[model samples]
Target chain A: MSGKSLDNRRVQKFHWMSRFLSGWAIFRQSFLGKIGLTLLALFALMALCSFIPPLVDPMYQPMAGVDPEISTVTGPSTRHWLGTDFMGRDLLSQLLAGARVAFMVGVSAAFMSVFLGTAIGMIAGYMGKFADTLLMRLADIIMVMPALVVLLMLAALFGQLSIWFIVFFIALFRWPGVSRVIRAQTLSLKHRPFIEAARVAGASHLRIIFRHITPNVLPLSFLYMTFQVTSAIIIEAALAFLGFGDPRTISWGMMLQWVWKTGHMFNAPYWLLPPGICISLITLSFYMLGRAMDEVLDPRLRKEGQTD
Target chain B: MGNGKQTILELDRIVKRYRTKGFFFGAHGQDVIALNEVFIKILRGEIFGLVGESGSGKTTAGRLIVRLEQPDQGKIYLDGRDITGLKGKASKDYSRRVQMIFQDPYQSLNPLLSVFDTISEPLIIHKIGNAEAREDSVWQAMKSVGLSPPHDFAHRYPHQLSGGQRQRVAIAHAMVLKPEFVVADEPTSMLDASMSAQIFNILLEMRRRLKVTFLFITHSLAAARYLCDRIAVMYKGNLMEIGPAEEVLRNPKHPYTQALMDALPKFVHSGGVKRYETLLQAEREVSGYVGCPFFVRCKVARAPKCSREKPPLKKLDDSHSVACFYAEPGIKTRSGGKA
Candidate 1:
């Protein structure tokens, strides 16, 4: 209210802004963070660019006929920048479309699983009698079961799995693991004085969970989500390579599956290499980002920030 | 009756018991009678200190008043209106009117929240002011609590502040709400001597400025002597003595009060002992007992019926009362309650 206090307020405003910006500034300074951000931006660009569509037929729709005279095999021509498949399908188009599919599967799977798991965990942790017993026991059962085997069995039972089906089942199985982790975290957080403080502040049960408890658990969510992006992408790739991916979708794993089935893997190295490299680079980027973020969120991991 | 003090808060015979897990995997462990038939009236603009040893239920009494834990029985009246069984908005409004400064500022505050956010959150929750007004309010609160310049301390986390500073922040949080009634539970036990004095001074200043009625809970009699207008000594969930602070300290009546006075480390001619008592007698489990909860260790319990029957809180004079049967030793008659 006073002139001096007003001046201090303005100074505080600037300080608060800087503290907000510091998270990004600190993250950008890290070596792994730079690479991770660059890789993410690059793939995101690829995924976005695929939507615009190029002038030429990058993927040879009818497989270009097996005859050598027609359009059987071609190296990197002006039309197909990456090259052509043994069946003469354009490798560049496959790569572009594959980026879109991987992005969709990865983001959707991670988002859904994390959202569902956080909800389950918050409820189970905060409201701990029957809800905890029921939800946690269910999580335990799902966690104990072999995830890949279950995914495969479900894929086979459905017969030619759809994109949504894969996303649904992958998220369903994945959430149990996240729920258990978050439940353990929420159990501890619910007892903290801050939670009781919120209760005293007139917060409803929903508000306490969503506002008070959830924000405290947000760092874990971000950390889990980053690793989950990698896991979801890998799981999608694994499903596709095992011939369980949606037949209509042309993912990186489907490209590899084609290369393996055709027996010309060594003879035509270009077809085999691009998808494998993209998968590794994307997953590696996510892993690096996750690790970098771990250091940022939990300052104890950073050497300079370490203090009692 | 002629003290002209208006009662701001009153508890009418409240009882609370917590059932802990029994040892050896039994279905029932030792149940703790946190408070039993505890009654006290806090007057307006006065510091009423609830002094007791550990496990004496002083904290629980404070907590009951704050409605952090509800009493299993009895009524709580604020401003002579029974605010018992308040739910939803009523409960929140009660919180707004009556705030608590918890014992440990370290664990009481949320680590992720800045000091500004911590103090301003109550304002935001209550929807008291807009952003700019809140900034000003927060600045004023910080200044009042002696974390002056406000800007330096406002943006800092709990870890960055010292123990004394953290307690100041906690005090600011309650002060921002402008609650008329504040229950400060050992607000300075964690701080050093000078720091504790500084905190006590801030509390004293707040009381003078705002006419805030405080129920100060502490085990240290020194703190009671320093700040409280009135004092109540508790033992094993029962109130032993209640009176004007100076009168009770000078001319104590209850056996428990005398024991506490004797136990004071010879520094009583001054304001208080240099340190808090290191050896509080190990509390005996007093649940399911009929007599005085203090009977197990009462050095002056002369009556043959001391262990067999409970004594009533009887008045000896205008401003003093004790729960001892032999307060007037010449009269050997049982007053009111049956064994």
Candidate 2:
């Protein structure tokens, strides 16, 4: 806190920061939010440490690094920590690298989908009548198709999908659900007096949609992004387990696939449980994050007697 | 035209109708006539009062003048230039000189916007000035609206302010551009008595300092009497009476106006608050009728004449007009002013 008065820009920034801090205060009280944040932090740390093992020892690399001494799957020991897989690759390093992939696939895909959905929804809602009907019907058409099945068909048609392509398709398939929620939010906001005030203030339609409507709907969009992250990660994991995932990437689903394919599904408990547990926990954490955010974004969801 | 003053805004036979959605597809429900051939002329620098009950189309009329909605069958002239169908640059230009202050202070200001952003919005939209100059304009507007020590309130959001403070911010938002005409639609309806008085005083100050013409739309007769130079009473999309505020409040001519005056609760000690008792206890069914809108509820209405025809505005004096079959030079009541 400076003694001198803050300038206009600083004041504007401070306003948003204060809003966020207050929201954080409310968010911190939710049990789900605390657990979700701690789990996410752990996964983030694991993702960050994924590069360290490969740097210290080449054999600890998740892919293309074989332990010269181990020829078959082994139980946990000082040598490999979690254990060595049938391919002589370290399961712990593979699990850490999988965390990195999960974060990448989840966040990038969720961000892209949310950005697309919010834009389309705001336009469809603000520019009602023809544009609204057309866009909503299109959203309906895309939403009904199962995303995973479509991705499998695409993978079959164009062999060996890249990791980035999977993220892109996940985004493409995932936007309609977000668009529906955002569109509904935008519809409720369209007739609010504030929007009318903006129009009466001589704002162009573009200005009203972007400047006025965007900020109002953005919190909802970001809340949906957390839920979208959960779905994107699950979809990617499913694709990798089904062997449609990018072959070059080391993901938890790919590790599960290796364990199942090598007939170690019953014998290798160490390799099997870690990747499966990691996948489920990461998705659960994101879902919990979304739930807490939903409570934060909508005040009506807060418990009775609570006051801002 | 009544006192040789310039008419800043005129609504010539404005009619606005909204069609309600029917139960089934392709079925059209009744047209809700929000405004029906309503005519008004607001003079430059005068506070014109538009008084009506709820659903009387007063707010709709305000929305029309501000171009929030277009009149179905009329021309709105700003300084004699027809602005009913203004589009593109012309419409944007029209908005620069015309503004509105909405009724609900809590709903009118965007919750996400801070005080500075809300007030400075008009300047930004119109591209009026650079950042520093815009800040100066916002500060000046805030000061004029009594949001002093600009730094203290500039960063505060709408939720942090009380009802009156929010209304002041709303007024500042409307006044920032120094618009020539403003339509304040029941701006103090949601505030407490003292806050309403504060808002009224701010409006008076704005008119005094800026010389901005106002069409003050409200349902409160006392508020209209306090702030308006001229007052027009509306009922069911029809204007019942239009006159100088004092003359109209003191000696109301129309039966509906008399009923409205009769409905005001009088103090026991107040001397001789006359009641005309012009309202019928049982409302007459008026489906598909073309008579005066108030004919169904008027106690003094006559059958075969008042029920058969729609009355046009008839002049009783230089500045007073009423739409009634049997309007007379109203009996003078001892004016015990302000309760």
Candidate 3:
């Protein structure tokens, strides 16, 4: 409370605020950050589109006949942006709808995977010995199982897999890799003074694991989640492409399946191209976002900021 | 607060043997004696130093006292209560009363936690106060350790701080609970010489201000001399000598104690003359013995007896004790030496 110390406080606060501002400025300056922001904005726009009904007229069908005339003059028009598919559905509308499905499966599955994986890993690493032995063995078993084969088996048993079911399957299988990552991080963190400090402070085992250890593993979990989301999207798309998806839903994968089944690639390339491009863009965006987060969350990456 | 309740901590005949797994399909494992029949008592408000070489079981003894590891055979009493095999809530309470400070400051702190959360977590867990009060206590604890402008430090992460700063944060975290006893296991070993002195000074100041007892473990004989009121010397899991710091350092009756004193750098010495060469020669001669733990290293050790029989701690004065067979009444060597 002395005048000198009070002045010192003001100086320290000023320094901290300056450092935070500079960090923010540097993040904005990075190309990866811009890409991440753009992808996130696209995802949000797609989510918003889900709430707003599609602009296409449900009854209107440009390809009324079996072999519709292929149009070459169509680039982007008021009637159909990005041209029309063989079925004459609005390509832009289908792309937007596909975005909604991709984002849903990508985000939900990733969130579930990270949450369950982090919790189980923290418990296994912190409690150690018996709990560690049991949980890691289970994780190893899950890790060795082929994800696609298991999903196919489940889909066959269920007759048809819905979007939610696909998300659940991906999330369940996605945890093993993340759990292993988290467990490794936790093994080192559990020995730290802060944990011992917590123990001496009379914190319970549950509190120690959740409050102390969980925060330490969060950056790793977050980075892993981003990668998991990309993987989940790929898995869902693979399932839909293999004709195991819900019949009523019109995901990009289902669009591909229908296009391939109808021989649209040989007759009408436009029909197959739109869905293929949409899937690639969506998956690529998630991969880029994961890479950006890897740079942001990793200490080694951030340390280079000083040199730069 | 009552008569016969002065002893805050006691370890009686404590032994810890670690069982190592056999190598490559071997039938049997090896038993390494980490602690062998060690006994010590810490009175209230006294700083007791346990000094020894590495693998001497000083660190193991500290861990056993806190029940971080269980002793193979022993009874540990705290405030007249036998807490040897206690677990769950009782063990937790004991831990709260007696905390530990580890050697590596960098490895000892969670890298992800901010300074505020790191120190306040314990307070929150113990339900010591409301959120506002906990914040106040965390700031207060930081301030006490000279982590001044506490608000600044509260939001900063561990990696942002220097070695001395991190150690200060660690001390604040340990002291925030207002524990009655602390087991500092080579707390300053990881610090530089200058920082080590500062840390020792802070510990001394805290000891005076809070009246907390300390079981300070270290391999540094000079540190033991500087900070401790009483010193116990150990060699290979044996408590070789225990007495007043001045008595032990000035007139060391045990050969191991004498060697440790003789080995100390002379510039830091307040009384002893230069005897570095003699100490080094003795150390070389004592490196081949299979008998007494120190028989291989003791220059003054008598043949047959010194190498054959392990010495028991014998009282030489009211406050001084030495563990050597020759430390008995009327026992004199050729030079009339009293070791």
DockQ of each: 0.33, 0.56, 0.33
Candidate 3 chain B lowest-lDDT run of ten: B330-339
What local lDDT does model 2 show for residue B209?
A: 91
lDDT of residue A94 for candidate 1: 77
Q: lDDT of model 2 at residue A160?
A: 87
DockQ of 3: 0.33
Q: lDDT rank, highest first?
A: 2, 1, 3
Query: Model 3, stretches more than 4 Å misplaced?
Result: A1-40, A43-53, A56-78, A301-308, B1-5, B24-28, B112-116, B129-143, B148-156, B268-290, B327-339
Best by TM-score: 2
**True interface contacts reproduced, per candidate:** 0.35, 0.75, 0.49
The TM-score values for the models, in the order shown, are: 0.83, 0.96, 0.86
lDDT of 2 by residue, A75-176 (tens): 999989999999799989999999999999999999999999998988888888999999999999999999999999999999989999999999998999
- Which prediction has more favorable TM-score, 1 or 3? 3
Q: What DockQ does model 2 achieve? A: 0.56
Q: Which tens-of-lDDT digit does each residue in B193-284 have in candidate 3?
A: 99999899989988999998999999998788899988899999999988988777766777777678767666655475733221324343
* Model 3: per-residue Cα lDDT over A1-308, one tens digit each: 24434554565577557655755565566677668668778766975674443423542222221113444323445666556655555555656677778888889999999988998888788778999999999999999999999999988998987778888888899898898889998998887766766666677888878777886688789888878888888888888888997676667887777677766656656667877876777677777777766655554665454421
